[model samples]
Target: MSTTWSAPGRVTLIGDHTDYNAGLSLPFGLDRRTSVTVRRADEPILRVRSDSPGAGPVSVPARVLELPEPPAVDGWAAYPIGMAWALAQAVPGAIGPFEATVTSDVPVGIGVSSSAALEMAVGTALAELFGLDLGPAELAAAGQRAENVAVGAPTGILDQTAVMFARRDHGVLIDFADLARRAVPLGLAAAGLGVLIIDSGTRHEHGTGGYGQRRAECAEATSVLGLTSLRELGVDDLDRVRPRLAPNVFRRVRHVVTENARTARVTELLDAGRAAEIGDLLTASHASMRDDFENSVPAIDAAVAAAVDAGALGARLFGGGFGGACLALVPTDRAEQLAAAITAGVVAGGHPDPVIRLAAAADGPRREPDPG
Candidate 1:
């Protein structure tokens, strides 16, 4: 038997560095996705391969029940390997011998949650192949398990939740405190605006980057502030807490508190049909990510600057922000010029060629038809 599963990569419009603090985030899945095609194997072995973002392909041989500890593999192999371990735990007796080919356009190392997409796709495909029951939420939890334990990243569930739950015409407003989410209508497309993702051409492996350090700082600040999480604090509470913690930790907490409010305001603006007013909030987010969180890169800044000047309604350095793409809200008619300007600016600033993708809100993971 053969089966294919697909899940879209996600982009965070605002609320960076807020997820781990139990704050709010606004993320939407894109049309681009990672798909895994699995076919039964006669040798009682499980194998995996991918054509994107890595040193090379991988082929692991093992029984579904006796899955080994996730090996420390090179490049993109760890994501699938880690995911396999998680899936086996979720559906031990249901899995059997199979080989998978992973294909994806959502570039890894650029912070679009490609790892989560791959994990979600693999989890869902394996469930379907073996007749195991798994819902999107369970699959998302499985995906997060892979990332945290096997892959060694302390990321929150924002990306996985967005991938599993968002609608085609909206962004999921996630309150990480309780895992309760509501879909906020993103009618930008209906308002003659388009969302664009421009890769700044730098790679960030979340496990070994500034991401961990920032998370550590937040945890430390939470202890010093006497709060359960940053979610307990608000923008108005920052001034009072500012003098209590170390300078850097205070700034990190500040980003979380204000960013949570920003996410809500972005939702309000989207609801009010005032897509253009979001530009300041987007730019402010970039500044906070740069100044307070100290996560922005020069390539991303250049891309955002050029895109906004070109015609975008708003643009911000998206995702985890050490080095990744920027998301821009632009006039649908001027997307080409906006992309061109970003490319030209990055090139002029002496960076690698940037990649630009235009996307709309997309549905969550689903089973693809059997191949013809």
Candidate 2:
């Protein structure tokens, strides 16, 4: 029998580093996604293949049911392998002989959670293949476990959750503290606007050193301030603790505190149908990420500035932005213009031409592709 499953990519409209700190995040699913096809096998072996260029197939014995001490490869296969390890942990005898063909339109290394999409796709496929009664949240958590523990990446739950539960034409407002979520309506089209993701195509490794360093730094700051996580700190708390932190930790904490507030404000604007105000928040969030969080690279900053100059409502480097993508909120009528501007700017900044596309707010993981 043929089993086909897909998982959507994610964009964090606001609240970046706060997820692991137990703060709220607002993210939306993108039209871009990764799909996986699988079938049961007679032998007790797990095999995976990717259609993407330079990626090859891999096979592992089912009898070897544990995660690699350190993952065997640093690329696409790590996701599926991590998922299998996670499933084996959750459900004894759940991972068995199977073969999977993976394919995705979600651009890799673009800070769009392409890796999570792949992991979720595989996790869902295995769940279906084995008749496991996994709920959306459970599936997301499983995928996240694979990333965080198995793959050793310190990522928050936002990417997996957004891919699993976001609804079309809306953003998911996630209370990271409680895992409570509400799909906030966005009227971009109704307001004659579009969301543009400009892929810088610069791949950075979240698992390779940088991500772990940042996580450790954030954790150290929280510990020093006597808070449970960075999320517990408010503006006043930041002011009170600012003098004690190193200059860099102070900046990082500043971004997290202010970014959390910005997410709440953006949610309000979305609920009130004030589409025009979104750009301002987007720009502010980008500035905070760039200056305070120290995430933005020169290429990312250039793309954001170019999009705004080309009449985007607001633009910012999105995701874990050392190198990845930038997003722009533009009038739908001017989407092409904004996209072109961002593309040209990236090229002018000595990078390759960026991939530009219009992304609608899309639903999270579903059994069937969204109707229309």
lDDT of each: 0.84, 0.83
Model 1 lDDT per residue over 1-372, tens place:
789989999888788778889988999888888999988878866677887655465666664345456656556777777777777788776677778888888787788888888888888888888777888788788889889878888888788888988689788988889988888888887788888888888888788869999999999998987779989997888888888999999889888888888889998998898777888899888888888999999999888888877778788988887998898888888888888888998889888889997888888888898777
Cα lDDT tens digits for candidate 2, 204-289 = 87777566677788988988888888878887777789899999999988988888888999999989999778888889999998
Clashes per candidate, residues 3 or more apart or on different chains: 0, 2
- Which ranges of candidate 2 are over 4 A from the true structure? 66-74, 368-372
- Candidate 2 residue pairs in clash (backbone atoms < 3 Å): 166-364, 193-332
Which 10 residues in a row give candidate 1 its minimum summed lDDT?
A: 63-72
For candidate 2, what is the TM-score? 0.95
| Model 2: per-residue Cα lDDT at residue 79 | 85
Those runs of model 1 whose alpha carbons end farther than 4 Å from true positions after fitting are 53-57, 61-69
Q: Superpose all Cα atoms of candidate 1 onto the true structure and report the RMSD in Å to 1 decimal.
A: 1.9
